[model samples]
Target: MEMVLEFLGNIPWWGWILAVIVLVFLYDILQKKHTILHNFPVVGHFRYLLESIGPELRQYIVANNREELPFNRIERSWIYASAKNENNYEGFGTDRDIYEPNYIFVKNAMMPFKVENKHPNQKDPYFLACAKIMGEGRRRRPYRPASVINVSAMSFGSLSARAVESLNKGCQLSHAYHNTGEGGLSPYHKKGGDVVFHFGTGYFGVRDDDGNFSMEKMKKLVAENPQVRAIEVKLSQGAKPGKGGVLPGSKITAEIAEIRHVPIGKDVLSPPSHSAFKGVDGLVEFVENIAEATGLPVGIKAAIGKLEDWQALVTIMAETGKGPDFISIDGGEGGTGAAPPSFADHVALPWIYGFSAVYQLFKKHNLTERVVFVGSGKLGFPAKAVMAFAMGVDCINVAREAMLSIGCIQAQICHTNHCPSGVATQSKWKQRGINIEDKSIRTSFYFKNFRKELLEMTHAAGYEHPAQFTMDDVDMATGDKNMINTLADVYHYHKVAVPFTGIKDIMNCPHLGGGYEPKKEKKDVKKAIKNEEVRY
Candidate 1:
């Protein structure tokens, strides 16, 4: 042993370093989870290390200011400036392509109406008004929403405890509401902020052992948490319309399991549709039931698809006069922690289109007075918020922007459960990077500046209140000989047409194959008419 120790002590420093590298290379080859590491040994770690920082590299170096997906550098810079309450002016003019299709511009008033020049009040604006839902139910009186842009549906399970705490604290300071996205109701949500308790297909906070909605549990929840200002029943989110919400088992803690009433270490799947309600009638009744139980305003959140289906729901409301107090319209461009590519990309209508269609429906049926609209999906800026208001959305919901305010670096690794920025993971070590107090202050500042800028635009448009903005205040840049057209001219009406009738009436359609058959009744239709009939 003394001879061996003497030999090791005699080794040079370079020799010791080489030996350590050789051992690590052997360990890498022995590992099975990563095929790259197995094939390349120690050299492969560089790929992963570089991949981990790939987003930052692209954001800062490779990608130009305007050439990024989901969000660009220009947009992110504005958010950062607002969060820090710093000057966000560009040195030169915009780098945006003004001649691009779908470009938007706000029409300023030549002679703007001047309201009292007052300090940015910082008071929570009474933005929305709710109608009475249930009769003689001992419910809390409906209070006006504090701000136009409030935190959107971000589940507690998708974010760490510290992240949720900071969000709640910031919301409390800003007099805004924090939405408890379909995960479950947790203690971290009750940090003195107004809460919007959302129920997805899982019914996480109010479900029984059999995974069914429980009225008794809901009643208990209402009795305990009076800070819950509203309830949002999520029909579908824009990012993944027909897919259920999936929380990987690795992110779930024992406390999360208890809160959600699920088994520990099991992936939690919220079904695509609600089990508590069946049809339109059933849905209206469910809304009434929750409103009655909690005495708080109730609403539904959905990504718009199947125009007929949405019209039918609103028509029933007009007929029965019993429905949700508000509707949250999610645009197809909305972000998510995780989603299937097909559903996220091609399923639902964009925010402006969905909002316009839904608004037209409400107006058509004369139900606009009863139902308020909350528009969501990438609405993080003042101009975008104004555009939504101009199109009849009562308020807006900000999710990604709020995360940015509290230090999400757009790493886009939220689903991996290894978010390096500490805003979207369960790892205690990662969360330690976040300072709650500092982030909370930044969140409040971001929200205040957002509201202030929106109001400024409202006043510049010669409108006293943002709600007064109409189609005349905004334009869609067409980039034609005539540069732009008012929103009213572009989206004047929701045209109704007979869909797929052409296919049914075509005489000997060129596209027809031998398998084609006339559309007929189920009783008369058969896959194969006789035993001799062949089918693919």
Candidate 2:
């Protein structure tokens, strides 16, 4: 004990200084920046003050085995392994948070194999969501796929060029179509696969050299890719449905600005509403013009506001005898490129409520035959997709899940653009740190397996085809643990077709293949051009 005290007492006062020096040194090396702590000394020495992803970082760099740590490491590695078709198992043991809530297991018993075949003969369902716009003079039309799933909008610009390429390849492999996010179509989009080019208000893919919308240019571009199956005008989205995107100037490279036709360093604002189409008539006109120009499927994506607003759209469709090919509905949970917190938190309608309401309106308009519906917002699990299909959506789109497959730990830093995962970053150094090819392979495998799980889920539900799903298939569980068929209590009339679209053209659209990007013909919306201004 005396010796221990002597050792402690003998410690020099300057020893503390040496320890601080060591910490600063380690921080510098870890940060790879000599100047990070030059002025601030001990405090400023450590640049980033957040919780270090210590175990995750080690798995990526040191362990090299990929899926090692719980949160970040092994999960991304598993995806990478699956994407590349590499060996998936690690001899170590099961890696997951087993204690998480509702961590149930499959009661796979010796049930007859015939149980899996129950839905094998079921047929695909169809939707008819047709509508017309107001100002543009043409009617909008959209078509839903026969089967249930389609690649949600994930543009090359919003994602990395490599990420887009891999996803397109996976889409082709999975026999699915990929939606181009609001980002314009770039070379990365054409992975020799089917793509739905989503046009935001920016006119990304169709912009001419001067960055203006060129109908001729759009026609040519659409013709070039036979995979360009559909066109979507993004009116709004689930996450920031009414909010325009804000591309930090750093991310807006010359090429991107040229494609989007917006100024560099300026916040790229796609105004919440389309000025060219004030009333329902104008909305229908634009849809018709694009359909005529493209000779392919076209639709819109948006969030539902007041009932009267959507009813107004139905009325316009009936009055003009024109409608969109389909409507892609965004829920309050839909993810966006970036948005202000307030708008994301408070603006949009939940998917189930919004989708059902719109589905009823389509039935009422009698336009449901030619148009289709695409659903988004939290489509990560097989059960989630199945429930949505039963509720009424024709197809499902997923965003954050795809990111997770490609190694996003939901760090909530996507808008910052300094993604450590190669999938989201453009920085060669940061991206280089992540093996793109490996991660892509993982992404493909994860999704493929997930689809199989969907099939399994449906089989368990006593359904075969994805289209056989209906509201009755989904049951609501009461607080008392009692279950009741949705048909007993859910409203069916809400989904019926509407004759009088009660409000202005409903601003909601779907985003399965992509989003709707309305064209603004009126140079300035403030000055009166022709008709009376629409009252808020």
Candidate 3:
């Protein structure tokens, strides 16, 4: 009470006026951005603020029912259904996008049906596809994700403790895997849910008192967390490939210090490349060592780089016989916490391109049969996932879009530590706005809907199962009807060795999505918008 009185005493009559003026200024700035402008200054910010909460406010505050969220409406309902142990959804009319360019809408969709209809609308995708991680002749394991959609790498420090707890608990409730991003694994990470503890270049999960990788400590962590499903060597993320992660020291609170096992108030850097491995061959060898040492699937995450590097990598794999269980492709346009504006906007290939390129590369090396590909980049929609698979990707991962489904307003607050959605902020007040139970239910609901939509579309794509649909099954219709991009037109025999012969060698990953023109394939997907000169 004294502290409150003291705080109140500190503010003068002008302080309130100054605060209001500042708020008015911000409101004006935001109003222009949200496209909900009003002439009123102070009052405009209120509308801008509420507009900023566009989808979230509608889903959580206004829509008496929880299932009526943006994008992940069904997902929210599914979680509520599972929690109450009741039916996930009620009979409903269509809840989908009706008008949008470049959409995959059913030309003649069926009229709305009741939840009790003979065909109980599947709450989730009925069929799950499996990806075979290639090892030696018989060493392949099918990587059929229990759920088509899984959590992406949102680090613990980057998010709040309650946020992490909610995500872990949510994963447990939904029976899906959550990634322990580059930040060191928190105790909250071991909340009895499957985890993909990505061992970043800084060796976060293995750091010690000196803040470096400790083999013994790593072994201990692996032994303790039975739920740790896999170990990913995150080489480069899609948003900022060839860049290091920077967590300023000031933000490192006591709890964060304990979780990361690093001293508070010290900047942490996870470099672009790992200290453990040098080149691609060394990369493969180290992944193998980690898998052998940890007894779990070991894979690398990267954005599509130079074609030559990829070609060289496949050759190394063929000769060394060290094949990864999976390869997670991060697209150039992917989102991240706080990257330099340049890197965030102009770094790697878009997921669509990365998906195609990596898919093709894996096929050419015949590693596609052995190594599964998990695609990530602005992907949350069923059409997006199916398209990636049609282009050769095994699975897909979503980040910002997933956050959106779970009530993130994209206020760009992940780095500022002011997320109104508890999912990203450490602030107690902002955190309260994010009801863990409600958000978690919303999370599962979103994933279920995504799966169901994919199944429906994939089934329409002429495949009984999502996995059965091949590239030949997809067809692209553009204004230039003369240039048809069919399933066959998109993929060539994924030959392991590119003919670097008389033809200038080109690095092609099927994930690059066969460009509008084959000649345009050389442009990196990341450079799609800021194109300067053409170079693959």
> By TM-score, who's the top model here?
1
Tens digits of per-residue lDDT for model 3, 1-536: 99999998999999999998987677776666544444565655577577777866666566654244223445444443434345644576645443322343222114422222322213322324233322323221212344556788888788776667666666665556687888878887777556778867778768776666676676567666556656777888876889888777756888877777777888877767777767877777777776666556777788876667777777777777675777888887785567887987777777765666666666766666567678787666666676666655665666666566556655565777767776676677777776767666666666666666676675565443445555555555433544445544544532232111210111122121111113442233224312311310
Q: Which of 1 and 3 is ahead in TM-score?
A: 1
Backbone clash pairs in model 2 (N, Cα, C under 3 Å; residues 3+ apart or in different chains), count: 73
Of candidates 3 and 2, the better by TM-score: 3
State which candidate, 1 or 2, has the greater TM-score.
1
Candidate 2 lDDT over residue span 1-536, tens digit each: 99999987888989977877888666655663545465455666244453366534454566643344223455555545544556756786765444443232222224422343233223211111122221122322232232245568766656777677777666654545678887787877677545777876666667666545577766677655545767788887876876666567666766667667667666565656654455666777777777777655677888776678789888888777776767888888677477777877788788877887887776776766456677888764666676666655656776766677666665566677777776666565665655556655665566666565666665566544444555565555432333333632454642322222411122232311222213331212212111112210
- Backbone N/Cα/C clashes per model: 0, 73, 29
**TM-score of candidate 1 to 2 decimals:** 0.83
> Top lDDT: which candidate number?
1
lDDT of 3: 0.62
**What's the residue-level lDDT of 82 in candidate 1?**
87
* TM-score versus the correct structure, for each prediction: 0.83, 0.69, 0.70
Q: lDDT for each of the candidates?
A: 0.76, 0.59, 0.62
Residue-level error in angstroms, candidate 1, position 351:
1.4
Model 1 segments beyond 4 Å from truth?
1-49, 118-140, 479-482, 494-536
**Alpha-carbon deviation at 209 in model 1, angstroms:** 1.5
> Model 3, stretches more than 4 Å misplaced?
1-144, 478-484, 490-536
Worst 10 residues of 1 by lDDT: 127-136
